[model samples]
Target: MKNFSEIEAMARMHHPDLDARLAAHGHLRTAQEIADIPDDRWLSTMTRCVFQAGFVWKVIEAKWPGFEAAFDGFDPVTVSFYSDDDVARLASDERIVRNGQKILATVHNAGFVADISREHGGFGRFMADWPASDQAGLLELLKKRGSRLSGMTAQYFLRFSGWDAWILSKDVGAALVREGVVDKPPTSKAAIARAQAAITAWSDESGRSQSEISRILALSTG
Candidate 1:
């Protein structure tokens, strides 16, 4: 793969204001900041990402207050114990999206978050302790343990929750292919590993966060 500077130059060619755009995109939290985030917020973000999947994000955003109310502020300890009755009630509740499966996913993910919080003292601590270099491993863990947290959903959850992460957007995937990191958008385990390695190497060389590298890759493609 080419050096990250070369990739950045290509991005600048496409968008001359790449740096300013990147500065406004989003900020990565410090480990301390991440460790201080409450478990409820983690659960809330996770549920939002789950619900946003294959659905209209603007609608979700507009009705988010109802979602917050309906899910009991996404307190992991409370939502983790939601029963079948609770599921039925949420499904019938017009305040939220009312998707039964997604509601169920919220319940499952609450337990997932609560369990981690118990084990690690706090879910934020668990996330803070996870090394950024192994984001693929982190994503795999989310896929296996958290409900509806596979693929881009999991990536967005991590990103939105202030975890240092890279999203595999279409443009980023295209740029990866251009760099010969993978022959296609990385779906298979092997392909994803290759892409991760390429990004990790670029990060080491460029001293840029993975999210920034991801954005640069997307910009470079256009």
Candidate 2:
């Protein structure tokens, strides 16, 4: 693969405003900041990502307050204990999207968050402590343990929750293919590992966060 600087130059050539666009997204949080995020908010963010999957994001955003209310502020301890009766109530509730599977996912993910919080003292701490170099491993953990948190959904949850994450968007995947990192979008274990190693190496060379590198790669493709 080419050096990150070369990739960045290619991005700049494609979009002179690349840096501006990236800056508008705001700075990533420090490890301490990430660690300080409350467990409830983590659950809330995860729920939002799950619900937004295969659905229009604007609709989800517009009704987010209803979601917050429906789930009682998404307190993991509370939502984890939601009963079947509660699920039925939410399924017919007009306040939110009322997708039964997504609602159940929220309940299960609350348990997932609560469990992790118990294990590590806080879910935020667990996220902060995870090494960015092994993001694939973290993704695997989410896929296996968390409900509806696989592939792009998991990646977006990490990004939206302020974890230093790289999203393997189509453009980024195409860039990776151009760099000979993989012949296609990485889905299998070995392919993903190879992609991860490439990004980790680029991070080491460029001193940029994986999220930033991911955006640059996407911009380079256009």
Candidate 3:
């Protein structure tokens, strides 16, 4: 519990003043607060989040040793070739998330990744092709990939990977309110200054990716 609390606090500290805006609108959110991480880390983190859909980060972080070992450090070329036998093996691997469905999706997504690479050069290139400034196209991609993971819930995971920009609605919003980043009673003032202060402080110390930040925040609230 203590460790979880610390992780959550770390997340709160990483926000770029966006939380108050979300809160004012009755939403929960995570945003692009990391400006120093390399592009490759962003790609790999996306693949990792796909693999970790329903699992805890501590579990994934601990098992990351084996995940890196098994998946060739999440090399898209290597993971894209994962076969049915590979899927079965991963389903039983105790060191990883081990969920059958998620394991299969990870492998499947790898194939899609390979296609994206072949047609566009690489995942990063594909990302560039995405119209970040266009909401409908972005949401379409989100919904398409999101179909595999219980409606748009998977969209949040994608957002963590930096593939999309999104805000959390419903329960996650309630969770944020409980975290004390915002007052539940509501007001007109923006808390962006406080939230950005927290995020800047947290970002300077941790090398973890955006999704990791979100997990840390959720764990803090949990």
Q: Work out the TM-score per prediction.
A: 0.99, 0.99, 0.52
Q: How close is candidate 2 to the true structure, as a TM-score?
A: 0.99
lDDT values for all models: 0.94, 0.94, 0.51
Once model 3 is optimally superposed onto the true structure by TM-score, how far is the C-alpha of residue 90 displaced, in angstroms?
1.6
C-alpha lDDT (0 to 100) for residue 1 of candidate 3? 15
Q: Per-residue lDDT tens digits of candidate 2, residues 1-222?
A: 899999999999999998898998778889999999999999999999998999999999999999999899999999999999999999999999989999999999999999999999999899999999999999999999999999999999999988889999999999999999999998888988998999999999999999999999999998
Off by over 4 Å in 1: none
Residue 149, candidate 1: alpha-carbon lDDT: 98
Q: Whole-model lDDT, candidate 3?
A: 0.51
lDDT of 3 by residue, 84-144 (tens): 8888888787777777776666665666556666786565565656543342344456446
Q: Write the residue-wise lDDT of candidate 1 on 117-173 in tens digits.
A: 999999999999999899999999999999999999999999998787999999999
RMSD of 3: 11.3
lDDT of 1: 0.94
